[model samples]
Target: MTLSGGNARQALSRRIIDTCKAMNASGINQGKSGNVSARFGDAMLITPSGVAYDALKPMDIVLQELDGVCAPGQLLPSSEWRMHADIYRNRSEAQAIVHAHPTFCTALSCRRESIPAFHYMVAVAGGVDIRCSDYATFGTEDLSRTMITALDGRKACLLANHGMICFDGDLDRALALAIEVESLARQYHHARQGGTPVILDDEQMTDVLEKFKSYGRQPRD
Candidate 1:
């Protein structure tokens, strides 16, 4: 059944807050740097701009519709709301979006590099590599369009000279993917320091992608 009323709204509001706190605590985020959003009905529940995640309450979550109209709320939505909204409009499977500037990911992004297929797990982003979007001013429609194009076939992408963005079917998955992006970024940085790490060929990456389709599912008895 479709959830409604104050109970439903409050529950989702709390989830958004919790997800933000998790992002900060998990090292994928620092301070109020990152923003999070989740799909809720015809609108999206997103983090309030400039508020520290720990200080957020259920009432502080901002709910804005896809039509650009925001419901009455206690605070302003994140400045990057356009990106989150655009992601929802472009990707039917994306239920949650997380944007952050983890140390490694941000460093790589500043260098305008994408995480390559040096590791098989890179397939988790749904491509041969996590593409880096072209540099664009943050919070601008131009940036949103660039990010949308970068995310064409991937679940995540690094915002050139900005940070990283990740989305999944739910908040937990979105947050986990953000963490994974940072992990991959760190590993890739180290790999380059040692030498040109051998990258997995398209054929090998394709095989890994196929395996990921059913990874962790139990076998039939």
Candidate 2:
């Protein structure tokens, strides 16, 4: 009942692969350091680890169940697969996940800095600022727990001394959010070199958040 086979899952698999390559092409991810996954049925379709995106094919994607079981595939899931699984289980609204080590994001992350609302678009992440989780070793349940806490009510968060994670209702939106988050991180990085950014007040951020509810692409009536 969940696009388990036939053409639907195949199409979904291809989209996941393309997004993985797109993540690299967009410069938000370098090499295979980042990972992408999309929710399907009770499982998720995620990119395999250590596989160069350019060399990736649809068949190479790993199908991971929420319970930690991955369908037989030619390669293993990304080392960060547990994080992806945990997010889906914790946040039912999350349909796609994107984790990347962008230049600016990673720089701030290394400093364990959070992106304040120096810009209005910070509201795009569903908050007044992009939170940075307390550092935890990657690929551990502890890391996922910390990330889940940091991500509460927010679509994206920075992993302390690591990188950033973002999720949305679908693959394209999740990818787009990742790119935007990186841009915000870059602007914040440059802003910091001068002085502390003047953050937007909670009231202003709340207004912007409400406006975002109907902003961006809209579905046809």
Candidate 3:
């Protein structure tokens, strides 16, 4: 929805805060280590840096333009706002984004590893694998560039030595995608502990991706 008026903008801001709190409650993130944002017309509504989610008020959310500028007098935006801005600038379909340091996802990212197609569910990320961005210091344009590269043609990816990021058409789905990526990371990690996981071939993943187009929706009458 477009941020056409004060009420609408305020609503989106509250949703961003709620998503941040949910991230911690769901165990996908802890403390203020993650951020959430939603596309609001030409600007984005993002969580503020250093503010605990439990204490965030509607006005505390930062309304940042895609050019990286936030409105004057507002709290500072997330330290990683550049990455969110870059994603919104580059990915037209990203209506909402969730960036979190989920335990298993971060563990894999620390090793600079990508999640391969060890399970068909890997296709949910829009490909046969979830790529890990090259390491760069957080909050830098360089880090944003690498994330954009890793996220090419995908809805989710890992930030090397950092965390995971995902997006969808709304705040809820974006948060859900983050959780799903973490679950996938955990399963992949455990699978490796047993033995080398038998990765599905590209052809198999291709078929799975095709089916996902209609995987969960109910047919219209």
Candidate 4:
């Protein structure tokens, strides 16, 4: 049942390509500015570096060991694979990860501040506070460490001056969180333009978090 083997790898590869296409068409990503990966036992299936999402095929995905070794295939694994690998290694519940510079999420990430709990819906992100990791250059160990820290107990986080990253038990949930990050970021951006955004109180956020946990449902995030 190792993620390093046969059928699991194939399933993961197809999912990666399909997810890349879906994210691209939804305008949640551009060029090859994003990457997706899924845990298959002890290995990972990730989008190939610098490849167009639209052109991705099942076999175009790259297989990498948990230690980051890659087998013969199309292209190299993404530079951000470090971040993905770290998260998968640390978060037992995380089976899939998506990183994207979606318009709004990137806009908020560049603000030099945190994305506040402006809405209770933020609870869907595994917490009311979606942290923005300290700015780190992509593909660097520093960046990986920053992301790993920011993701502590949270399902989604923004990379300072970079983009958004979301992790979930499955690809669907991961993608949902990515989309939510973008939507919430857009809402926060517009609200800031209007005036200081209203943040949910501690008690209100707690209630939302509990209710969301109870429902066990996904809302676009």
- In terms of lDDT, the best-performing candidate is 3
**Residue by residue across 1-221, what tens digits does model 4's lDDT show?**
45645676677788888888788777889888999999877888888889888787778788789788987645888989999999988999999999998888887789855677998788878887889999989999999998888888798999999989999989988898899888888888888897887789878888988888768656785
Once model 1 is optimally superposed onto the true structure by TM-score, how far is the C-alpha of residue 103 displaced, in angstroms? 0.9
Native-to-model Cα distance after best TM-score fit, residue 111 in candidate 1, in Å: 0.9
In terms of TM-score, the best-performing candidate is 3
TM-score of each: 0.96, 0.95, 0.97, 0.92
In order, the Cα lDDT scores of the candidates are 0.91, 0.90, 0.94, 0.85
- Per-candidate clashes come to 0, 0, 0, 4
Error of 3 at 137 (Å): 0.3
Candidate 2 per-residue C-alpha lDDT over 1-221 given as tens digits, one digit per residue, 9 for 90 to 100: 64646466788889988898899999999997899999988888888889988888888888889877875645798989988999999999999999999989898889888899999999889988999999989888899999999898899999998899999999999999999999999998888789888989999999999999898867999
For each candidate in turn, give its C-alpha RMSD to the true structure in angstroms.
1.6, 1.9, 1.4, 3.4
Clashes of 4: 4
List candidate 2 segments past 4 Å from native.
Answer: 1-4, 217-219
* Clash pairs for candidate 1: none
In candidate 4, stretches whose alpha carbon ends up further than 4 angstroms from where it belongs are 1-5, 216-221
Model 4: lDDT of residue 109: 83
Give the range where candidate 3 is weakest over 10 consecutive residues by summed lDDT: 1-10
lDDT of 1 at 20: 93
User: Which ranges of candidate 1 are over 4 A from the true structure?
Assistant: 1-3, 219-221
Clashes of 3: 0
Rank by lDDT, descending?
A: 3, 1, 2, 4
